[model samples]
Structures are given as C-alpha cells and as structure tokens.
Target: MTTLQPDILIAGAGIAGATVAAGLRGRGYSVVHLEASTQPLDTARGDHLGPRVVETLANWDILDAFFAAGAEKRLGAKWLTPEGVVIMHSSIDDLPLPYPFYVVLNHDLIATTALDLAVTAADYDYTLFRPVAARDISTGADAHGGVTEVSITTPEGEAVTIKPRMTIACDGRSSKIRAACDFQIAHTYDYEKPFVVLFGPRGELQDPRNEINSYMSLNGGVSRIPRIGGQWKIGLAIDKQDIGRWKSTTSDERKALLAERAPALGEMETEVAGFYPVIRRESDYWTKGTTVLLGDACHTIHPARGQGMNFGIRCAARLFDFLPDPTEMSDAALVAQRLADYEAAVKPLTDAQLSENHERGLHMDCTGPERMQAEIPTLRAVAADPDANFRYRMTMAGYPDRLDPK
Candidate 1:
C-alpha cells in the first residue's frame, strides 16, 4: 500500500483531536488527522465548556470562532434538593477574573470550526484522512532515539504504513491506539446507577434562567442543561437494574417517569434518549514510547457535573503547551518531552476532579433517613456559609489561576 510520512499523526477528530491539531498547526507543525467516522459528530454532545475550557480555547485564537458559531454564554449553576429547595448558586460573573465562566455551544460545530481553521490556515500543512482506522502500533529504538510505526487501515480496507514522528491518540474511551500500545488504564467503576440523557425543547424553567439546574431526589437525581436552539438536555440517573425496566416500559411510561422525576420539565418534546452505564477510567501512564494518550483515552470522569468534555478540553490545552517544534528537536525527544509535560500537567487535575465528582454524585444520590439527618444539614450549613459557598464556586470554576504548572 501507499506509505506516508508526517511530522505528527493524530487519531480521532473529536474535540480533543481537532483542538490539539489546530494548536499544533498554529505552531508550524505538520500533522495528519485520522478520523474513522465519515459524518460530522453529533453537535448536541459536549455542548458546554467551563471557564477554564474557554481560556484554553482563547489561547488557540479560536474563542471568537466558537462564540460566532452560536455559543451561548452561561451565567452559572444552581443546585436544588428533592423538594426544590435552592441549596447553592454559583455565578461566573461573580468570579474575580474576567474570563467567561462558561460557554454552551454545539460540539459538532466547534469541532468543524477547528478543523476548518486547521485545514484553511495560511500555513496549512496537515492532511485529514477520513474513514481511516489505526489497527496497530510498533515501536523501536533508533539512532536518534525512539520511533513508532503505525499500521492504519484506509477507507478501502487496505493497510497503509505511516511513520510519523509521534502518534497522539485523542480517541475516546475505547481507543484502539491505546489498546495497541498496551497502556495500563487505571479505572474506578461506579455501578451506583445508569443514566438516560434526553435532549429536546425546554418548556419553562424560571429558576434556572441561563444556568444549569441539578435536582437531588429520594428516587433519583436529574440535571437539566440548557443548549443552543432553545433545546434542553436532561439526564436522569436510575438504578442499574432499573435500566432494562425503563427501556422495556412503553413510551408513555417513560414520559410519565420523566414527569415524575423532573416536574419542571413540563411538556417539552424529547428528540432523543440515550442510555449508558456510568464509568470512570484513567491511564496510569499517558505515554509509552512515541505514542501518547490525550482526552478520554487518558482519563474519564463521571458526567455528574458535566465535566467530561471540559476535562478533555483541558488535556488538549496541556498537550498544546507541551508540543515541541518539530524542526527544533529530534522526533523522539520531542515526543517524550511532550508526553511527560502532558501527563504532569493533566493527571493531578483529572485525578482530583474524578474524586470530587464521585463524591458529588454520591451526595446527590443520597436518600433515606441518613441523608435527611446528616447530609441535608451539612449541605444547608455549607450553603448558608458565604465563605464556603465562595470557595465551592471557585473550585467548580476550576480555580484557573491555581492551575500553575508544578
């Protein structure tokens, strides 16, 4: 088959992959992006990015594009109890910094914008290969240092050998590149519940005007996220065993359950309903030879706080910071340094976020007398204390200034 050589080879053209590619291209690095899917990714997915994620996008000079692409400015987030008691409210405008707190945009639009920028930039030198899959990766020591040979299957199903300076896997959780490299994935499984995400029109929600609203109920927890085009995305967590029953139930039963859990939703029409088991996994090592993992391939957090895509965006920014100029150093050295810096910069943030989100999920799912007696009082106290609420808001905003490299 045909053989090609590029400065860098990136697998997966999702948000993480596209963002990294755009950053590297700006720095004059040649790249080849391989995307397995031919169609554009679903825009509805990953529609929100926190302030930190916004800052990262700004650094790449693409924030304006994102905003122009119909990204809605999010004011803040609100937390509520089963009885609709407002427990906590955090606003982005309240932050000491001037950065936008959050932006809600179609993920597909963002990816497409970044890709378009990368492909059309004045110094565009990267090639995007669609319908391409990386099947295997072989690493070897070279006179300079280390080299990785990647075997990619093209749309025609022919295996083509591509020897890039390095391979960055921005693939999602089930990354074939990570599997081929045999990287150890450290994961914590949360079987507490399965969640069904419903996307559709938002009828009427006054309390959560331009903000996300989360409700903790005795039966379950639900999060309502506002999206572009006046659509709202709602996630309802249910017992794992109840998933089958929920799926088997008639459409009317499901609709009734939605009404029962989130009465505020009213009569909004649902366009789609997707369900999946909740899981969190992180790679022990982000690098192996010339291959490195980024985004969900490296770590995955619970969707409770809607931080999965945000975390991936941060990882992409870290990788952008560590990327080396191909002309300045050997491919092997650049790859190693980039991988080390990426792991060093991202692991701690992701680890802490994973832990914090797990605890938050547990707290939100709490029920029974123990919750009413212990958790509710503690939450009320935390909510009542201005200092505590301020600190909580800062933490949720990602403490951007504190992300200094250690």
Candidate 2:
C-alpha cells in the first residue's frame, strides 16, 4: 500500500464519492475519502434507488446490509389524480433483474454504510477523512506533464499533500474542487425552487401493496413514498418564484398547502422534514488532466423522478467498468481518456433522461383548472398507450427504453 499517498483521492463522501471509493477499494485500489461535514448527515434526499441501482448495490454485496438498516424494497410507483384515480402505475415485480424493485434508504446512510464497510473490509485499502475540506488546491506537475500532487488541509488546520494517481470531485453541485479548478459547465436550467420535502409517519396511506403515489392536480404536485418502519417521504414540485412565500408559512399553513396541492393522500403530521432546490446543472466535460468529476459535480437533474442519486450511482458503475489499472495512473492522457469514455457512455443517456425529467416536472407543476383538464386526459392516454407507458415504467425502474418491440 502506498501509505504516504493513496492511488485516488475522492472528494465529498456523498452517494457518488462513497460508492466509487467503496467500489474501487473493494477491487484493492488505495483510496482516500474526504468529506467536509462533521455533523450527522441528513440522508433524506432521493431515497428511491431504482431497480438498476438496487442491482448495483447487490453486485457490491451491500444490499442486504442496506435492508438490515431499514431500507424498503418497492416494486413500482403509481401516479394518481387528486381524486384518487390512478393515472399510471409502474412496476418491476416481473423483471428478470437481480432486484426488481427500487430500494428506499436514506442517501447519507447508504454512503456512510458503504464507507464503513469499505473501511473495515479485511483487504481493502481505504482511508477516510471526515469533517475535513479542501481549503486550498493546486495541481503539481510531474515529469510527464501530468498533475500528480494535490494538497488539502485537515480540520485541525494541518496541511497534507497527496500524490494521488487521480482526484475525483464527487462533491455536490457546489463542489470545492470544482470551484477551485473551475470546470466549465453546460447547464440546462429547468424550473427551480418551491420544491419542498416532508417526512414523517405514514400520513394516511399505508399499505404493503401500495407503490409510490404521486398525486397531481391543478393546484400542484406531491409525491408520497413509503419508507421502512412505517414512515413516509414526500416531495412537492411547485412554482419557483413562490419559494419565499412557502418559507414564511407555518407548519400548519404548510400542511394546508400540501393538502391543497397533493390532496386525497390524507394528512401528514405537520412536521417539517427538509427542503431542497431542484436544478439542472451539467458539466461541459467530465475530466481535466488527472481530475474527474462524478455525480452532482458533473450533472444534476431535477428531483421529480427521484433519479438524481440513481444517475450518480449509474455514473459510479460505468466509471468503475472503465477504470484503469493502478499501474497505469502515470499516463495522464490515458486517465483523461478513461474519464472521457465514462462520460461518453453516460452523458448522452443521462442528458436524455434529465431532459425528459425536466419536462415531467413541468407537467407536474400545473396549477389551473384549464391546465388540469388538459393534463389529466393527456396523462391518461399516454399511460394507456403501450409504448409510452412501457417507457414510463422502464424509466421509473431505472431502465428507460426497455420496451419490447410490438
């Protein structure tokens, strides 16, 4: 093991960074994980790990532990009109995939759990530095004109330098390494803001057979997803400009708004879980010299489909498939090519996915009687149509475009 410097430095211990770290280290690569936050993680965002992601977890052999830690398995989801009519229901129960269901777990827990396992695995060479951030960064040159040295400061104000083979920026959209390095982004800014998340007990709808239910109407759109231990996680897609008005509302007032928006799902406990912004931010390139961007650092899609982290996991898996042998790390060109390959494989597919999701979010934000009349019927027809509905379920299951030719 190169104790003085690891082969790879993974910035940000969220889903993407942690997944890649655990993944590469399991294959016996040396990795150093850096995370900025010391406080307990709020693992509430994007709990739905679609069938593809669940299969990835199973391949990593971490699914069992995830379930043990209270992750729920869901076969599909249902889209409903506010009056409780099912507009569309997507299922994966019959798929031949390893896990024909979405795995619902706290994102923070999955990352931490995977990290914990990687750290303790008997043969994996993985080190973790939490509550530490990249205070300063610079690329150090090597004989081959590659960036070979990277530096950071620990939480105790100690300076440390790493001659890593590669540095991965998995930090979220606001990535420190990304900012310090200034990776150019090609953004598709869809609608933003007024997105709210509510978490509490199983409000009113609680059933083992029930898939995720997204109720929509002229008022707004709210999705209620079931969780393990009889809890619930819900998301709201609303007008971007009304975010301030939302923030000023009381819990009771907020609950009332959800009632008006989602409707018919029954009442939640009026406890605020969390709020997040939904934005579409995609980077122009995935690699620069020896550094690579993964997850939100590379691309961020709207949360309407609950596919943000799943897409990141997909990036991790594909990148894992394309990773170079540790001995080949000295070839900067080769590293950049590999990152490019991963990006090439993932970006087109994810770009399409994000665009479709953005359109879906737009459809979900309808707030007028006329728009509702136009939307509900259109949704019903599409849901009834074989090809489109198949695509819908396939997308929800994380395997978009899996329809058999008719």
Q: Pick the candidate with the highest lDDT.
A: 2
The regions of model 1 sitting more than 4 angstroms off are 143-147, 156-159, 202-209, 248-252, 266-272, 329-331, 361-375, 400-406
Model 1 lDDT-worst window of ten: 138-147
Q: In model 2, what lDDT does residue 359 have?
A: 81
Angstrom error at residue 382, model 1: 3.0
Would you give me the overall lDDT of model 1? 0.72
Candidate 2 differs from the real structure by a C-alpha RMSD in angstroms, to one decimal, of 2.9
Residue range 158-224, candidate 1, lDDT tens digits: 7788887778888888888778777777766664766677776554444334688876555456777
Residue 119 Cα positional deviation in candidate 1, in Å, after optimal superposition:
2.4
Q: Estimated TM-score per prediction?
A: 0.88, 0.90
lDDT of each: 0.72, 0.73
- List runs of model 2 lying over 4 Å from the truth: 1-3, 140-147, 155-157, 188-192, 202-205, 239-255, 364-366, 369-371
Per-residue CA lDDT of model 2 for 231-264, tens digit only, reads: 7777776667776777687767777787786666
